[model samples]
Target: MELVKEIFQHLNGWGLTAILFIVGILEFSFGLYKKWKLNDKLVDLASILFGKLLMPVLVSYFALQLLPKVAPEYKEIFNWVPFWWGFFIICIADDLTQYWYHRLHHEIPWLWKFHRTHHSAPYMGMAMASRQGFFYTLLFPQTYVTTTLVFLGLGVPALIARGVKGLITMMAHSSIKWDKPFYDNKWLHPIAWVMERTISTPATHHAHHAAHDRDGIGHYNGNYGNMFFLWDVIFGTAKITRQYPEEYGLEEYQDDSWYSQVLYPLVKSDKPGSELAE
Candidate 1:
């Protein structure tokens, strides 16, 4: 346990990159061999490259310049607290910021264009974490917030938050559906409901990836919560469909190469009806 705790201390900027790399590799391999979902592969690869490689570095650069002035008292606060309290604050703030950014992705057209790459995947797995568009992470508020926290002398806690959030979000998107067996047990409903309402579950997150508004749709526009579903309930965006999607991915997507998906937003394609063609 001591060594395990020490490894967590080493997880900062580059550490996050390494962690994401291992996760992306495991998910990609599973997605290719067992799940073998072609449409999802492009999305997985794009998200990893953009979210992991470009976004954090850019956010940290800007955050470092601002944090010294914005939250100079952070170290003082850190000094006063027990370590776990600081850790909890970073984790909660990180997720709260992510919840809004995620909700915005569904409502804003420009943001939707980027976020759709994630919804474009027909299947969910660990790789689903990597299903974002190139440059998409630049607009993510959570990335900025996490970076700011780090620069404010809450760096270790921010890393801890990232690791915890990653585990929750990735598990929620994983192909393994964990809710089914629990459902038939009458004893579990109250506990499950409380947990689901407070935090995200596979049932809720999978519903976001759903394709349409029909019974099969899983109510995609709602359930915009990240680690905590309560954010949705509090904000009036929560959807409570306990069912998973019969079908997934954008209803209108046509196959495009990885190049087009990554570059079109920046390059502006001429392809007819392309998302960026206009």
Candidate 2:
């Protein structure tokens, strides 16, 4: 168990970055990124830097400042927890929280603009995985939950759960379409059936990024799971077609500038009729 924890920490630190980099390169090499506009490029770059680098540093700083003054005794407090049990608890808590946070952003009309940047890209790719507004990423509930759990002595399981969830969600957002093999092969249907419901797959997640839900393949209103699809299934938001959407992103309002998309209310879009426009 200790060995597993170390491996997860290492993987989350390096393996996550490596996989996203390699896959991103593949997408570029395959011309999958040819359609990416400059606006999309800037938004993705800022989002990756903010979400990956700054968010962690800020979160750690927050934990350090808050924990010492309020709950010094709680630091590493849950270290006594058995690893697997801790993993199970964090696995359910983190992803389930993300599921709701993600769902609410779409269902709530007022909150939609905050998350609209994520669904503005016209294609499916790794860079778009974290292309959320600054405030949207900052306010993600699961991130704080995981950070708090780590401070509370569940670092091992929290990190493991985070690492595993990170890999699943990122791959699901990649342009590689790796899940197609499962649907193409007859022998894998049973496995695919259980797996699709168990975790977020490219098909299911991509459907949520569809430009319009007019097509039967698109289900942008639902399929809000981040790591686990079980939340969507249990909550009646799941949709599995074993197929990718023909068109990704929003059907309208594609002209939102990168600054407006990333900065949001602090810098609303100048484009008239844009969702980000005040």
Candidate 3:
């Protein structure tokens, strides 16, 4: 347990950068990004890694700064929480919170603009995985949850939960069909059954990105899980197709600029019909 904690403790910026780059390489090798335009490249690659990467760091920095003032008595106060218990608590709390947060963005009318950038891409890959409006990242509840847990000295489980969630969400958003074999092999059906319901996968998640929602395959209204599909299943939002969508992204909002996608209210889209438009 100590060793695992130490390892995750060292998964710094460079390590995360290497992982995203490697995943980008995979998506490129798979030719998933063959149709990418310059704007697509800029929105997906140029800023995703750095802009999204700073999200957590900035949250942590600001959180740490304010925590000392607001809750100085609670500094490392939760250090006594057992590692496994902390893991379970954070795992359930963080993911469940996100499941609702994501669901609300899709279900609520006005909130959709904050999340529209993520669905603007015509394809899925490591690039799109981090593509989101600035306010979305800024207001993510899990960012505060995990950062608070870490500051309170549940750092080990907090980091593990975060890393695991990241890897799951990344794989779920990836263009690579790594989960294909699980559904293809006859003997693997049972494993596939549990795996699909246990964690987010390309098949389940890609369906969420389907352009048309009522095509018997798409479920843009559901499948809101990130790390754990179990939340969707339990909350009655899960959708499984075992098939990739023919087209990805939104059918309505097209040609939104990179700056508009990332900058949101700070930089609305020029398109009068866009959700980001003033």
Candidate 4:
């Protein structure tokens, strides 16, 4: 456990950046770079700068400070629990919270405005993974859950689970389509079945980002899992087609500026019909 924590601590700063660059290069090499627009790049850059990097650090700092005052005695309460057990608890709590959080973002009108930026991208890639509204990132439920768990002495396992989740999310959003081969090969079908059920895969996640659902391949309302697909399965929101969508993004999208996309409601858009407009 100590070794895992040490390794993650060493790589934490550069890991996400490295993954983005690597997957971005692969997307470029495969000629999918043309699919990206200038606005898309700008939104993605803003999201990475604000949502992934700046906001998380700021939130974590506040969480750390505030948690102690609210419940100091609860600190490291789960430290004595077995490592695997702790990890299991985190997987269930963090992922399930995220599942509902994500589902609600689509089901509710006000919440959808904040989450709209994520699905605004016309294409899927490593960059789009970070394309979220600033406030949406700030109030992410999993962040609070994970932060509280860490305060309760589940730091090491929580970090490890976070690392694993990060990797899965990055791949799930990447244009590389890593899960395709598993569905294609006859012998790998068994492994693929288990994998698709166990975790979010490119096919399953892309379906969620699909612009429309009339095609049967796109499932914008379902497959709301983050780290684990089990939550979706158990909750009856799972959709697995082993197929990719022809198009992505919102069915009815407004051409809101990058600023409005990232900092909506706080920084309203000048566009007359935009949801972010006053």
lDDT of each residue in 138-239, candidate 3, tens digit only: 888887877787778888898777777887888899898999999999899999999999999999999998888766888888899999999889989888
Best model number under TM-score: 2
lDDT of 1 by residue, 1-278 (tens): 66445545555545444555565577666553354456556656766777766775777668766666766666444545556877888877888888878778789987777776677676676666666667666667777766766665676666667776765676677666667566668899888778778877878888888777687548778888777788888988778767778777767754555555665567654557867665
Query: Model 1 Cα RMSD, Å?
Result: 3.8
> In candidate 1, which residue pairs clash?
none
Stretch of 10 with least lDDT, candidate 1: 11-20
**Candidate 1 C-alpha error for residue 31, in Å:** 7.8
TM-score of 4: 0.93
Local accuracy of candidate 4 as per-residue lDDT tens digits, 104-219: 99999989989989998888888788889988988988888888998899988887788788888888999889999999999999999999998999999999999899889899
lDDT of 3: 0.83
Residue-level error in angstroms, candidate 1, position 246:
1.4
Clashing pairs in 3: none
What lDDT does the true structure give each of the candidates? 0.69, 0.88, 0.83, 0.85
Which pairs of residues clash in candidate 2, taking residues 3 or more apart in a chain or in different chains?
A: 211-249
Question: Model 1 compared with the native: what TM-score?
Answer: 0.80
User: Candidate 1: lDDT of 185?
Assistant: 80
